[model samples]
Target chain A: MIRLRAKISSSRGQSTNISHKVGTWSFSAFVILLLTVIFFPGLFAPYDPLELDVINRLQAPSKAHLFGTDEGGRDIFSRVLYGTKDSVGASMVIVLMASGTGTILGAIAGWFGGRIDFYLMRMVDVFLSFPYLVLAMALAASLGRDMRSAILALILVWWPSYARMVRGQVLSIKERLFIRAARTVGASNFQILFWHIIPHTYRTVGVRASMDVGYVLISLTGLSFLGLGAQNPSPEWGLMISNARSYVLASWWYSVFPGIAILLVVSLFIYAADRFSGAER
Target chain B: MAQLLQILDVNKTFKSGNSKVKACQEINLTIGEGEVVGLVGESGSGKSTLANLVLGLEKLDSGSIKFEGVELEKLLKDKSKSFRREVQAVFQHPLLSLDSRKTIAWSIAEPLVINKIGNSASRKARVLELLAAVALDEGTASKYPSQLSGGQLQRVNIARALALEPKLIICDEPVSALDVSVQAQIVNLFLDIQKRLGVAMLFISHDLAVVRHISDRIAVMYAGKIMEIGDTDDICESPIHPYTQALLSASTFTEESDEGREKLKLFRREEVPQKGCPFSTRCPHAIALCREEEIKIQSFASNQESSCLRAQEIFPNLAKK
Candidate 1:
């Protein structure tokens, strides 16, 4: 056992660990990219997202405008960059809300079992019955169309998925010896849920949240596509796409660039989530 | 030392639909301070159920368990947490006993933190001290349970159990999953802890060799009832009950060669029957009464008894063979 420990410790120190390096790089890059879009949107965009130039209207890519202009002469490139603050921002809120609600609810259901689990899961099933986009649209429509409403709608629609995931994880974790050990140590039910069961759920649910962000972004964009999301003149990527759709044939750069912006963010999230799972292993 | 733990006619039954299972039947025993008691049994013998009962993890259908004269059930009411701090357990598997994602320090310090033992720095210091006490070094504090060796993890488990300075530790097959060499290290670690700390224990295992090595007294169980209870050496040297003799004969190391192993089969036979004596169907001396009699515990000596009808007549003959 002593010799085996020595071997493991020494091997862990070697530089040839390719997977360890790749995971670190991928995670750091995701953080840097997200922060640039979130906190320094102006610094990254070359042109003002809302700046209008009459002569540049429906123009194809030129030397001045890298992503060309939309029907209203606004720089598509700038709008897409600025648009991230809302699209990604709302998606982040939705992911947080869903994962938080789901994990807590699921943990309770799985941990306690019996009647609590039965009724709570039935509620989850009711929420899950609605199609993701339709439910978000219905919620956004009922609440009235705006960024905050859209985010609220998305949160309401998405939390059940997290709850289901969390509850399954909680059920399995609750049976573990550590949980029983915690009980044996006189840790209160609150402590066992927060300290023991919740930590285990975090490992499982953290990976799911990152992936869920990509899905939530797609769903939020779908709401915007149906005219139930961000309205005119807003810099959100989804609303920008809606406004630029008419000029697609004449100048594909407008809607295409914002479309690609959504794609890039979603793909980055998925990639980061995958890398996170690998790093944990 | 006074009796640290006492169980009086404890019973447990599970009802599922129309059927019922008597998981534990009239279990009674006493454990003195710092004493190690072994409850040896096959699967489904209610040893684990008894452990759960003492821990207040399961409610008994009848009877009561007292720790220093306080009823276990009453102690479990609102202050189950305090009751737990006094009585700890080391489960069968190390992998299953520690949360996989948490660091060894967090796992050990959690109970202390929840019980509000000390400040963060003090808790960390205490955790490190616990790690050191379990023979692990300072580096292990940050390592996750999955990264630790089985024996190291078991030692960490022991450390966690000792963190609250529990008066009694119930070890349910603590070393069963480990390799033979690793098992001995864990067993020795347990023995050392018991000796230095003087904490009472109810050690549950199916391995008689391990039971013999650690237990001050042994309780052999079959079909949810204790067949024999006595001093460890007495149980090993002179097992009175036919089932006890059958259990002893069936274990390895008793017969030398394959021929002797074949010859030993006469003493070691099949499973105990479902009803009556439980061992009646397989007993060579079985008569109509042996099959019809509802076996009850009979006294052989003080603090020693065998629940076997034919114990007196068969004791001398079995010892000779």
Candidate 2:
């Protein structure tokens, strides 16, 4: 556990800013409860995600199925509920993998410089030259239309941005005295990077990761919508949207609810990122 | 005297495309054991470059440096950990010198932990002991560097430097960033540590008065070359080199005010030449020979040396002035 010393005290502007935002119960509750809704969907949802009812097809909100049923007689409410878990889980994994790989590689490059910095930055440039969507599609197409391929593609495309962010932070941070001080104390390269530089970079990394959650979620949904992710009948929200888009001309509820779920989750991530970054500054 | 530290004819020049930028000239100095050698010069005087070279942070273009009997270059050639363990550095900015993420306890213990000197329990104990030695409370060990004052942070830096039990501590303007009162406290701490440990110190500063107080010997540097080197009292009372005398006259001494302000100026303050004497442009007494010829170290008064063409001629004029 990192024992954080609140150096900028209550009297400081940062503390006041943190206090002002934290006092709003709605925002705080949304952030905390949103995680629970994503992680433990079964406890929160009224119906089983996979359950279907032919009789309730195209029906609006009622006592039995609050969100009504889709064109194929599947419950819109249950699928959206379960979709939260899968969507968040996949995006979280993508972010963790990308950020982890990127930060490590970036730290090595920035701290070592010379050949390491030159090579790693060039690699990032190569990846960045391709459009993210095109690269993800290409990867998903080649690897077969599976959830894993889509995730792998997204991670591959996403890592370069993190690498760039981390490298920028590292360049400035490595020049700091603590790193030199670490060297003066006979600290090995590994120890200095992990123990000294990483923690300093993490503040910016944390904010970036929080903000990237929205982007990752959008990318995952886009892939699923393109039929390159989460196979049909999986109760994934993006697949539900893809399957429901035709019926939206008649039964509007089919597409609207899932879209709202996506919006709320994305908005929450963006808002949370804003708050976290604000507090840090 | 048996040399504790010796830097011989070191020259370093940086390259930019076709041209070269001379950062340090052919410099030589020998400091003895248990002595505080003041490396005094203004900003961009190559004082820091020389310090960095001695610490093995930067490679010397030519010449060699030795600490005791061991060659500094040879020591740095293989394992620098031992070199760091023997010769530590305290940087200019105390705030920057410490890890903000770590607690004071952890930062101080880092050196001990890195060197693998004593196990976990003993290291923790040692950190607390060091904190106390620096006149800080044990409670401060758990606090981060940002929580402490500037003076407190510098003391922590000093404590960290001494943790490796280094033979020499290269303090690069360690007290310049602090309040004048705090400067005294830290300087006194250096003196106290030197008295207790008998550690040779390469005390680098632009402040002549502070250097005079702590140093046994002084070396005045300009544009990376040592203009004069002698015992502290000898250099202060009767400076042989023109640059050294000009520097002394300008500074406000503890005993007297800037009484000779009119005479306390040097004119050779142009951009340091690519080669030859860096102070030549500023030297009011520079002759035609000063421009073409690089001044070499010439013996003068007892245990004193001046790097000037007209050291003998300038000595009487400097004393009379």
Q: How would you encode candidate 1's per-residue C-alpha lDDT over A134-228 as one tens digit per residue?
A: 88888899999877788898888888888888887777777777778878878777788987789876766887888888989988887887788
Please state the Cα-based DockQ of model 2 relative to the true two-chain complex.
0.67
Model 1 misplaced stretches (Cα beyond 4 Å): A1-24, A271-281, B14-21, B250-274, B316-321
**For all the predictions, what are the DockQ values?**
0.63, 0.67
What TM-scores do the predictions have?
0.89, 0.92
Give the local distance difference test score of model 1: 0.82
Q: B1-321, model 1: which lDDT tens digit per residue?
A: 799899999899889998777778888888999999999988778889999899988889899999989888778885436777788899989978888878889889978987889899999999988888889999999999878889998999999999999999999988889898998888888888889899999999988877778899999987778889989878877788766776677666453654654322333545655567766766666678787878887676645688877777776543321
Q: What is residue B276's positional error in candidate 2, in angstroms?
A: 4.7
Query: Once superposed on the true structure, which residue ranges of model 2 sit more than 4 Å away at CA?
Result: A1-31, A71-74, B17-19, B77-80, B254-263, B273-276, B316-321
Alpha carbon lDDT at B116, candidate 2 = 82
Interface RMSD of 1: 1.3
Superposed by TM-score, candidate 2 places the C-alpha of residue B193 at a distance from the truth, in angstroms, of 0.5
